[model samples]
Target: MKLLLLLLAPAIMFASERTVTMKVSGNCGSCKKRIVKAAEAVDGVKDAAWDKKTKVFTAVFDDGKTDSASIAAAIVKVGHDVEASKAPDAAYTKLPDCCQYRDRTHD
Candidate 1:
């Protein structure tokens, strides 16, 4: 029993923490707010941060309850484009002019 408990401890700890960083298209502070809020809304997501200049979003979540894909989907739902997922056209169009990262004219 002692050996079993010790062997499972590491696995349990590993399953509790997961961090992922991926590209998220966003141009300004409002975009950053939406992206981070979307990620944090997902179950098991402990924290999320997005950098406008780098277009990178980092998320920390519990592997046992959620994965990177779920977090990405949540962000997409909020009209941000993640590396593996893109927001729907309708959703993207609803973003404010300043938050339209896909529009090169604004850049």
Candidate 2:
């Protein structure tokens, strides 16, 4: 039992919950939904939110299973540009017209 406890202790210590925030390009409510859904879909992500006004994507995840880079990749896959990863033009072009933020001058 003592040996088992020792084995499990390191894993427990390393499996920490972490919160991360990063810039993600998006325009409106549709973009917000897509961004949040993509971030939360990662294996260890517990919750995610995006503020359209700030273009910030925030996520809570288990560090042992995932990280900020992985979360950003997920967002990029769904047509949003994250600080750590940029969505391909193919993916970006698929976003609905109103959800597109790149061509907007003020964004």
Best by TM-score: 2
Task: Give the per-residue lDDT of model 2 (tens digit) for 13-100.
Answer: 8899999989999988889899999988899999999988888888999999999988999899989998877899999999988987
- Estimate the overall C-alpha local distance difference test score of candidate 2: 0.89
Per-residue lDDT, model 2, residue 98, is 90
Off by over 4 Å in 1: 1-14, 105-107
Q: What would the per-residue lDDT of candidate 1 be over residues 1-107, giving only the tens digit for each residue?
A: 99999998987877878899999998888888898988998999999999877888899999988999999999998888888888999999999999887865244
| Model 2 misplaced regions, further than 4 Å | 1-6, 105-107
Candidate 2 clash pair list: none
Question: For each candidate, what is the lDDT?
Answer: 0.88, 0.89
Task: Give lDDT: candidate 2, residue 24.
Answer: 93
**Structural similarity to truth (TM-score) of each candidate:** 0.83, 0.88
**Candidate No. with top lDDT:** 2
